[model samples]
Target: MTMRAALCIWILAAVICVGRGHAIVKHQAEQDTVVDSRANTASLVNAANKEFVFRLYRKLAAHADSQGKNIFYSPFSVSTALAALSVGARGETHQQLFSGLGYNNTLLTQENVNQAFQMLLDRANETTRGFINSGTAVFVDNKFKPQPEFLETLRQSYLADGFNVDFTKTTDSENTINEYVKEKTNGKIDKLVSNLDPSTVMYLISYIYFKGQWASPFDPVLTKEDMFNVDENTKIPVQMMNMEEELHSYYDQGINTTVLQLPFNNSYSMLLLLPDDMAVLENDISRGHVTKWLKWMRPRRYDVYVPKFSIKTSYSLNDVLTGMGMTDMFGDRADLSGIAEGQKLAVSEVVHQATLDVDEAGATAAAATGVGIMLMSYRHIPVLKFNRPFMVIITERNTENILFMGKILNPKME
Candidate 1:
């Protein structure tokens, strides 16, 4: 690889190796704060800006699906990275966001970004600690925070890498942030933060954009009782979306692995590829043959039978990430000196939680629970179908940040 490319790879490797030790934000425990008002107010209205973010979500979803992992993805961090960029983020921001996630490298300013990192230091650390205690099986996991010194490294790297430097606007941090979320999720995600307390040290914002249709929409009326193979002795009431059709890349590989794809109304859709006999599907997923299979397939309709499911997954990402290569930033060797002079600073952690309710109303019926409830006219129905082994991608109209991508081999078991 060329020097620049090599440098990029090294930066990413360092992040992967060091990311696990960071912490989670602490304010999330404030339940009485009220979700409706905080997430649905007028102080933050950046509609056109939000649409732009959605484009990124779309791109990310497509790329993840292409990579072959049964993806249960999120681009919230990516969106935050972009937001940081909008306000002139530097190297640390890029490292924390890109390196931490295994996405392509991005460059930004060092001093400015480090300052921002310093601003969020305490909360970031807490987030990491939470992950260490919670774990990934919970579904929603927090992304780690970078140490201040690490943020400096990120800034220096970006400058060294020839990244375009742009001035940031902090005039209305809240408005800009919400606007970005709106655009990223096509307005599906709005008011990620409400009533930003200037005194509040750490503020986290995510944009979840999804647009997928069922391989076959369930007849709202014909929904009947069926045995959902959740496990050997577990079967429950499920609205089965049924359709018999031929698919482009259907796989029935050995080891009881089965893969299938269901296209959404747009370029995206839901994918459900399952392992026939594996006790746990994640093992099959971690082995890594998904990207190759997805890339070499065609897009065709198939007859599918899927059950409607509502899943809530919350996780603290410390261990899984530590296991994934981000080790340095966690312990002693961590270089977070930049956050505070002579002060021992390390990224505490990240905690991410997501709840998905898929039904005949549409693929991303999530909007009903969010901003869409108010803007009744702009609401798009959600379509939920779980039939063959398939993949699901929620991408924005432009940009590389994919909102969410993952395969539901068997929603029954998860």
Candidate 2:
């Protein structure tokens, strides 16, 4: 699948349909000496970033789960994995891989996009108080020697953790992949790759981990078992935490959904999205509606009730990715020659594993995400009860870069 795959998956969310092959171009850096400070460049980069995150979520949310199952992953994580590979991608291999990851070669340069993510990561990791981390790595078969330029780009741009191993030694190699995932995600995701195909040339992955403290702590003493309406037919008990004080929030009258922003000490926030209808996940959420909803939000205080929940999800993104126009890199026509001297390279598997934990204090998450690669929002506080299926997002306040997202279809499913 190439840019035209964008045509096949266009309806996953209408946001990305505009990215046609010839019509769209890679991102172009503004002709400024300090590109980061250029307002126009920053705005375009932010829009592209948000569009990419929303695009990935719309695609995954549509196909990654079965009926009644909750799902979550870092779009950034998946994109990061693909971005690392893009460093070594060439010819159609580079186009398909980068395009699938939402890079329009005509509109933005990889360097421009990479710099945007780098800035976002730096902003997220600026202080160690509230943690958000994204890193890349390559598990190469010892037989292959990666191009120095490819390795250098990964190191400089993505802060990669590169490794070499004998793919023929399945036991040791598998352990190595899992161990790296385990260590990077602070142990939240221990095993991402189970087995490496003997013919597998290299396995690339990215990991993201986040843990944030609520600006205003929810009192555990207020926690009580309550019913969360999964739907009209199913109501399950959940440990509900309450914050009675007025809190900032946004309520979209059009969608009849309420959005609440809970801040962290480190300039990050977990945005909760609660809609009256539980079946919204099955329906395509309008992209522009969310942008408007976020813009409309103003600080208004109100009481809030949220459940204490924990859940984990894992996926093989091959089909989902191909469905979204990323077909070439996984197949023979792939030209990942930029990675090595002469041996042809193609991705064998893309795996993602994610987990989320939320309580009165805050939210913590870890995972190995696919492009299995690696990677937010607003609110108001009018008295709200998240007594049904809702959504949660962790993001940086400045760039609004999403670190993680989850759809709690059934709070008790975990």
Candidate 3:
């Protein structure tokens, strides 16, 4: 069963905020060094988040709306938003969130989860090589006040900001929240909310933005028009970027997949998987496969052809979250009383948006000498062309956290 190649790319930056009882936060800090049990717990949480990432990916991929379309999102952004909501959730609502997030099996307590998130947030905000800004905030209705303890948890554990907006002023409220998101994401997402529901007491939102250049930049002179096979019966024109370099790659004979690692100037890397059967690979892929594939990859010189493209995606994940056993939080039975007393509150919506761009440039200009050397040795190398649909995953090398994950079914589709 030979399936077409699929491209999966991961990018960075995330923001989470809420209104009414929901909040969003944006965090940025200098890199710090630390060795403690909290750090260890953070590592464990990161691993569990990986599981959440794949489970969520499969769920989204199976959605009727996602069929034969491009899928891109920041799992970290969604998870962080829900985790922030969990701070004020009580009883069954909290339990469901913990289970849905794949945290019930672990030995982590609520406080532990908070601390672990804080540690991870600090690390994610560190911008040593590339730009990564992650944060959460809560936008509360002016008429309703949230409990002090709940806000404190969000501020301390999630590094979130708190705001009170008058929901009655729908347009003003929407602009306030959307402008904040636009600024944090570097204008990647201009509008995050629209047609505000007057009954909405709180809005929980999460966002991320990432920009990185290839370690071995492609030469634009070598890029040319190429036909990209979207599927068996469809093809589209794309500007395919070309490069020849010694890149780390592996072929899993058992699964009939070829994995390639493309590093950024930062500590992050994009892992591209080309499988013989897209369905089979998607069904069988797990964190274990990712770890094994990375471990087994060895460097080899190849002439690679990749499409230069940009994509943006937006999703309303209420149904998806409900299907994942997080139903109570969106219903009247939701125990969000912890967020505010004497007022009924429930999450009305959960929104997520992300964008990514790839081109022939790095943080610094591509080395002219390096390009010349690669051109000199290009003839004997094997060719690896990404002319078909494939999967892409962006991950932090040190923490092994999957910042973003998606498949490119059609590059021309925005």
Candidate 4:
């Protein structure tokens, strides 16, 4: 029998699809000047920086899955890791070139950290609003949130850690990509990603665009008369989309778990894993079993059955990330001196916004639009089983970039 698979690649992989493989090109003079100046300061600079950024993301994302928490992927981790790598650069070092981006160790404190976060948020909010040319209903914030003392410790340790640091900002390039991502994500996320507050050393920018359809599109008519499993002995009334047929790739058996892969247009796919043992294995399945299962696969079309559903989730990753393994970036031991002349700096927040839609046909509904319209939808057999905890992974076919990583500990809450 075919097993379920859900692999979480880094967010940048989606860049491959930004403009039909055009790479969202930038003018040479513009990028070259920024590179020439900050080259020595940032160790993980250049196109190759994406590799290191994703490698770090894979490890951290796996850890989050293992912990059984609802974790959202972002470029925040990549930017932080890059900043860490730039911790101790010299004038000749590329690290030295980015001297303008770091925090003043002297000014590193809780109040200052808050100011930096708010600054970035304000800029992103303004830039995104401008791109939409209208106000959006999207809510946004940062991922790193730690106590003031915890943040201070992260800063002290970072300075004491002695890592090479390089800091610089190229608004033109960052904003350009930010605009594309905002357009693709439908203004769910903002552009203008910057924080030159002296404490910040390096920056990594990531873009994610997801347009998926529910496996089962709620029949405005047949969506009635369905009972959803709420708990061990509880059930609730919900309009569930239901359809059954021979499915191409699907899980046949797994205690109470249900696993299904819903295909989108361009070889892109969504892997949904429902655990039979909800005792807390969703995270493990997300990190461990998914990759292993992908290795053994067969391709064929079959009849499918799924539920139609729609959900839009917004999350703040500050606590979830620190709880995993990024505490150093926000404490006295933060060590981002390489980005600038300042000593005090720590990560303050990470923000993520996501939307999912599923219906009968496939993912075609989401991507249904003319080119450059920043629109996409899906058409797939709806797989409705709200009986247990579950996870979802959205991936691009060519580069295998994971646009979004999520888990629903309590579907009832959603």
> Which one wins on TM-score?
3
Predicted candidate 2 versus true structure: per-residue lDDT over 1-414, tens digit per residue = 321110000001100001111111225765566754544444555676566676777767768364468877776676666766677778887787767766678877767766655554454455543355566666767766778887877766666667888877988888988787777666766666654566665666666766666777777777999999888798888999986654567777766677888876566677888876645633545446555655677875566789888887777777877887878877777777777755655665576777778877667532121111010013543468888888877666655666567688887675
Compose the digit string of candidate 3's lDDT tens values, residues 390-413.
888888766577878888888789
Residue range with the least summed lDDT across 10 consecutive positions in model 2: 6-15
- Between candidates 1 and 2, the lDDT winner: 2
For candidate 3, report its TM-score.
Answer: 0.88
List candidate 3 segments past 4 Å from native.
1-35, 127-130, 362-373
Q: Which window of 10 residues has the lowest lDDT sum in candidate 1?
A: 9-18
Report the number of clashing residue pairs per model: 95, 34, 41, 93
Predict model 1's lDDT versus the native: 0.37
Cα-based RMSD of candidate 1: 17.2
lDDT, candidate 3, residue 132? 59
TM-score each candidate.
0.47, 0.82, 0.88, 0.49
The residue-by-residue lDDT of candidate 4 on 299-319, one tens digit each, is 433333344444544444454
Q: Residue 315: error of model 3 in Å?
A: 1.3
